[model samples]
Target: MTSHYDWRGGREAMMRFGLADAPVVVIAPPPFEEANRLRALMATVARGLARQGLAAVIPDLPGTGESLTDIAATRLADWRDAFAAANEAAGPVRLIASVRAGALFDGGQGAVGHWRLTPQDGSRLLRELVRTRIAGLREDGREASSATLTEIARNDGIELSGHWFTPALFGDLEEAAPLPAHPLRTVRLDGDAQPADHRLAAAPLWRRAEPGNDLELAQLVADDIADWMRTCLGG
Candidate 1:
């Protein structure tokens, strides 16, 4: 359920929870359409964590979810601010974030799913996201005609989920980063060259999902989270 509480002097923080005293964890939702696709997985993680004696807070950062804020008005600073508030309300918690939000670690713990690409690469990824979305919308179905895919990949005004995305959104997403060099066990989803920015360790939680995987990917994520909590807090 949803409840409002004073976070940092009457800021009126709104959040959903599974239970209290379960080693609070904040699960950051993904961006755009993936947010919709991954809602089930996100909730699964939260509930799984709760079952393992961990409290989970899954808040819609400023512009997302049931947040009363507009997406257009949300800035990077605002996101970080919301994170800080969530951390405060939840108390010294480990973050289970998706996409850019995973970059918040202090580079001290093992990061599960995260990436750090340059602005150009990030922009490219955003454009590809736009392209895939447009392709998904066409009557031709998910398998876009090569020509249409190429065209969307190359230019502006590409439709994303039935709406045109301006260059501005891509520009902003490009500059975003989850600063802090937290100790990590990163799962590079795209198979990009490993970076020296964060240490490499085994990350089974974020490996590719097959047609009939043994355990649900979200459950694996939750398991790793519980492991982290145990290691850090003698649970």
Candidate 2:
């Protein structure tokens, strides 16, 4: 079931699954539009974890999703602490489950390992977000440069695409790179893995034009994640 609790100067929401136990993999969310696209899949992953006799918590990272708090006040540290809170709520984190740019915030603070999905370098993700927003502005007949979209947060603090990014958040994202700390247990590549023939090489789910809950795709990905988690935790 989904639950909410005080976390990192805001309340974070998470969907808890099966025989809640210690050392959960707190699933760090992808930021902005990506989060909207991947939310269903993430929940499916938690359900898969339960089926595997493991517990997982898919958190609504601070300033996003159900926690619509002061997004402008949010920062990298707040996200890290939120991870810890989710871990504490479940116990020690066996793994920090992260998706896409979300891997940028993996604290590795108290985790035994990490599990990353569609892993992306931080700076690249930020640039992608900027590009996406810029294209969006063009569609609206607004000629906005990536520079303006990138720094407008410092001025208007407006919602870009779907979520708010404050100046502080913008700076952190611009500087983010692959996490330098955590030793990952697994990285499930979807569409990024080799050989175009691979099943995981399907079109990116998070980039879908229309919002969808691809339960079939979600379950397939979830089962894959569960299998990897099992391997990481040792069969």
**lDDT against the true structure, each candidate:** 0.51, 0.70
For candidate 1, the clash count comes to 12
Q: Where does model 1 exceed 4 Å of error?
A: 5-15, 92-96, 99-125, 133-159, 162-168, 188-215
Q: Which candidate number has the best lDDT?
A: 2
Candidate 1 C-alpha lDDT tens digits along 1-235: 6655343223444455556655576655555554565566667777788888777766666656666666655554565667556655654545444433334321223323222211123444465565666656674654665456435434543445433444444445556555653333344423456453332233322222322222366666677666765655544
Question: Which residue pairs of candidate 2 clash?
Answer: none
- What's each prediction's TM-score? 0.64, 0.83
Q: In model 2, what is the error at residue 144, expressed in angstroms? A: 2.8
lDDT per residue as tens, model 2, 107-168 = 64666666666667656777777788788878899898777766676666656677677777
Model 1, C-alpha of 229: deviation from truth (Å): 1.8
